[model samples]
Target: MTLLDRLNQDMKQAMKNKDKETLSVIRMVKASIQNESIKLGKDTLSEDEDLTILSREVKQRKDSLQEFKNAGREDLVEKTENELDILAQYLPKQLSDEELTSIIQETIKEVNATSMKDMGKVMGSVMPKVKGQADGTKIKQIVEQKLR
Candidate 1:
């Protein structure tokens, strides 16, 4: 089944189980997917686009969690963690640090990225390979560390 199909099934399950948090997050995800489809004037999004949207949503939650934590808001951090956990279920398995490093090295070589000036080239090449399987911020940090 497609990601959308799976998400639909999960949403039904969440409703049946009366899981408010899970249901809310699933509904938000569905709404976002629908918005993107509307933007493109399509009935459904491609799986790649869905993954991209899911990753972006998860990243946003992570950013919020960091902000809350920095402000010593433990309650908000706990809620964000739960939301993050729900969001993570839809993402692909994340890459390990060693694996990410190797991929970044290969991307640098592929792009002939010898300096920070070529960071964009390296990022463009690497993102496609790592999308849905790695965090963009972490990937950028790795690439910068390698370049420096």
Candidate 2:
């Protein structure tokens, strides 16, 4: 099934199971996807578009979680962490360090990046491939290390 189809099925399942937290998170995801579709003037989104929205939501949650931690707000941190967990369920599995390193190496070669000056070229070429599979910060670190 398509991601949206699966989400709809899960939403129904959540309702049947009386899973309020899961239902709420699924509703939020549906709203976000609908908003994006409207913004793009499209009837529906491609899988990639959905993935992009999911990635953005997860990134926002992670940022909020860190901010809450830094501010010593345990209550907020706990809530953000729960949201993060819900967001993560929709993301692709993360790349292993070894797999990420290999892709970075290939990307550097593909972009003909010989030094740090070509960081942008490598990043531009690699990020599309990495997308939701790898963490941007981790990929940047690997790219910088390789470029340097």
Candidate 3:
């Protein structure tokens, strides 16, 4: 099933099971996707567009989790963590470090990146291939290490 379809199916299951937390997270994601489609004047999103929205939601959840931790709000942190878990279920599986490293190496070669100055070229070429699979921060760290 498509990601959107999976979200809808899961939302229905959550409702049937009376899993309020999961339901809420799925609803938030669906709303965000719809809003983005409207903004882009599209009837539906492509896979890349959907991945972008999902990543944005994940980022928001992570940011909120950190803020709650900083404020020493145990209750809020727990809730945010639960939401993050639910949202994360929809994301692509993360790339293993070895897999990520190989892709980085290949990208560097593909871009003919010999130094840090070509960081942008390597990153631009790599990101599209790994989007929704590798974390951006991890990719950058690997690229920097390789360039150094």
Quality of model 2 by C-alpha lDDT? 0.89
RMSD of each: 0.9, 1.2, 1.3
Positional deviation of residue 76's Cα in model 3 after best superposition, in angstroms: 2.2
lDDT of 3 at 146: 99
TM-scores for all predictions: 0.96, 0.94, 0.93
lDDT of 3: 0.92
Per-residue alpha-carbon lDDT of model 1 for 1-148, expressed as tens digits?
8778988999999999999999899899889899999999999788899998898899999999999999999999999999999999999999999999999999898878989888999999999999989988999999999998
**N/CA/C clash count, model 2:** 0
Tens digits of lDDT, candidate 2, 1-148: 6778878998999999998888988898899999999999999899999999888888888888899999999999988888778778788899999999999999888878899999999999989998899888899999999988
- Which candidate order results from sorting by lDDT in descending order? 1, 3, 2
lDDT digits (tens) for residues 44-147 of candidate 3: 99988999999989888888889999999999999999898888789999899999999999999988999999999999999999988877889999999999
Provide the lDDT at 112 for model 3: 90
lDDT of 1 at 147: 93
What are the clashing pairs of model 3? none
Q: lDDT values of the candidates?
A: 0.92, 0.89, 0.92
* Clashing residue pairs found in predicted model 2: none
10 residues in a row with least lDDT, candidate 1: 1-10
